[model samples]
Target: MRLTWIHPEDLIGHELRQARQDGRAVEAIARRWHDAGGHDAPPMAGASPEPAPERLRRLAEDLLDELATIPSPLADREPTGLDAVISACPDWPGAPLAAPGPDLAGRLRGAWAGRAAGCVLGKPVEKIPREGIRAIAEATGNWPIRGWFTARGLPDDVAERWPWNRRSAPTSLAENIDGTPEDDDLNFPMLALALLERYGTGFGTDDVAQMWLDELPAGRIFTAERVALRNLLVGLASPETAVYRNPFREWIGALIRADVYGWVNPGDPARAAVLAHRDAALSHTANGVYGAMFAAALAAMSLTANGPEEVLAGALRVVPPESRLAVAVREAADLARAEGDFERVLDALHARHADLHWVHSVNNAAAVAAALVHGAGDFSASVTSVVSAGWDTDSDGATVGSVAGGLLGADGIPDQWTAPLHNRVASTLTGFNGATFDTLAARTHALVQETSG
Candidate 1:
């Protein structure tokens, strides 16, 4: 068999562009290409290409399969208590608040504070309908979906109050929905705390990613082949087919949350990206990895500068130029600079790219783009812009917020954002109840010390 290598760029040119420009159906193009020779098939002869939806879906499914194989073995024993969890760390000095080396302490503090703010940011809108989000945005003059929590109308100490569950009260629109607000892995801050608690200071991105997969409950999850198929479909095609397509909204949060891994490494965004890749592979691929890389690179950069443009530039350096993610980010940057209204920019991007996937790569990439451009390096502004623009709001907001928080440090985050959450949050993961930001940070710090030492 004569082997022919199909570069990602070739796929983009032959498949992606065809779907975008030639008006060919993704499935027909894909089927023709598959029949002609699989990826090596000659470009369809005079085939009018369909839109990129099916191609996007195929890509998503392949990416998911790639993600499912990254192995993560659990610790020899499950943690019995907080002390048991803390005891896992031998390197942590367990230093008092007045201890030396405030930089480490500061990183720890910022991680916790960021976690709290993340919870507050995500709590009110966990299950909010699109109409509700729009209404809130219209009523408050802030983009409701993204900027709802940032409005000055909320209480001063909202986040700080223990048990943020009360804050989950149905947003006028959700009032009729039954049942209390539930927290799951989809909630970024809570997930962060869970990882911190389980791994302690040993929490590297690889470990975190594995933990996420392990949470799928061994027997109930999809097979590796099924995961691969699902990834390939969703990544390369449209995510509109919710039944079988990848749940990108859920995955992007996981992908972006790996930034703290990069942040701990310092000036090693590549290492961060690598770590993120390992984790992301468990559930995503291609642009999924790009999403993780973007978040990790931004977090790594945040350790050095507070400029959104600079940080985005740094992130772009890490992702391949041939990727849709790169293209989307570039487009977003252009829109952010040229357009005055952030919503308009998103609307424009959607008009062009929405068919690709509403919650997958292109749209999420747009969110990252909006955050960096409109956020201008302000933690609140970046998060607000990313979230408010809608479409995978939490994932984009979390990534933007985390990177901004990492850059600004704990003290740099506004009091209003941090003060409301009171440095506390919880997750659905079984082992990490009653976690505080300070404790999670201390555990993460200790893990790094142990790993690096």
Candidate 2:
């Protein structure tokens, strides 16, 4: 069944109507277009805007009719399973990469710690507008943002317009920082770990859907996952749960959950990407799905990659080369390499992504690519640039941090980044909350070994 009634003021609904005629959602393809510097729909020809209620009614009617018709050829694929995804992967450019020598456990530890640190760095400012983060950072002497933000002594007028994540500020700020707090960015990875342990590499999309039903809290899920959960609750099946009323299917949710797939696969990028696809397909499709695969592949290769550049290249090979997500990632990589200043690269990213939703995976993938490429193997440079670049700051920071940390190894990660956390990470998952990175890393290393064996 259709969502039937979307919020009247929802801009996604507005874009959905225009997109539906072509059988597209407001994300993925659209987000990719924006991330590569495309503009939004030109303003209505006339200055006077149409009435909201009438517009909503017309849009709703148009959407229902559009859904009844055959989707456009350009529209994203339906549920075709892993064979479709395997065929989609761009052929490996060179021999499959080998895993890093020595310190496997250390690298694993670093990834978990770095992900936590970078996520915490951006947490307080997660959804704050890019300019707002800039303004607040500049005010607090943190612009070009080398560290976590603090609320101490900022002008109210500036702070008023650019508020921190109110729910996050107490722990995310510099002074109060203790441990990595609960965030879906980390939570999904935890859930993924559970999924892997229970089903090994054979787990399918249906397994992931059932796991979510058993473990993840409804309130904790958002956007696509939330929509998919509602769909599952109401009787939608495996891939159907992803599409039914889930316009958010292409948002950053899947991307945020991909690290575990990579962590368990190490140097096996193809395997990692496929596992990510199985997991991502439960709630996302197209580039949204590709975002997870790309990230997981990056993580898998980071275990052995000589540098972020090599990791980035391996990642591109795991997704359809022609996909908009790949296009956006390629653009971000190119722009990042050419642009010298970290903030300037971000300025370019923000400008190009201005037309898309802040949380869309295409734009977020661009942000992640910029962080990895420009970061060029430095942990601080990597996390700082991604977080500073804005547009879902926490997720970008967390992902970049994970890649960089994996590449750098635990011993290589600076104390300044990890010490603040006291070597701890948190999640609400049973027996997982407030766990030490050391323990998680050890478990992850054992699992990766078992899977490879």
Q: State each model's CA lDDT, in order.
A: 0.51, 0.78
The per-residue C-alpha lDDT of model 2 at residue 448 equals 82
Best by lDDT: 2
Q: Which regions of candidate 1 deviate over 4 angstroms?
A: 1-104, 126-132, 140-254
On residues 165-243, what C-alpha lDDT tens digit does candidate 1 reach at each position? 2435342112222211223322443455456557654455456445545553332222221233334434532222211
Q: State the lDDT at 296 in candidate 1.
A: 69
Q: Model 2: per-residue lDDT, tens digit, 199-286? A: 8889988999988988888778777787788878889987887766566677789999999899998887888888898888888877
Q: Per-residue lDDT for 42 in model 1?
A: 26
Report the Cα lDDT for candidate 1: 0.51
**Candidate with best TM-score:** 2
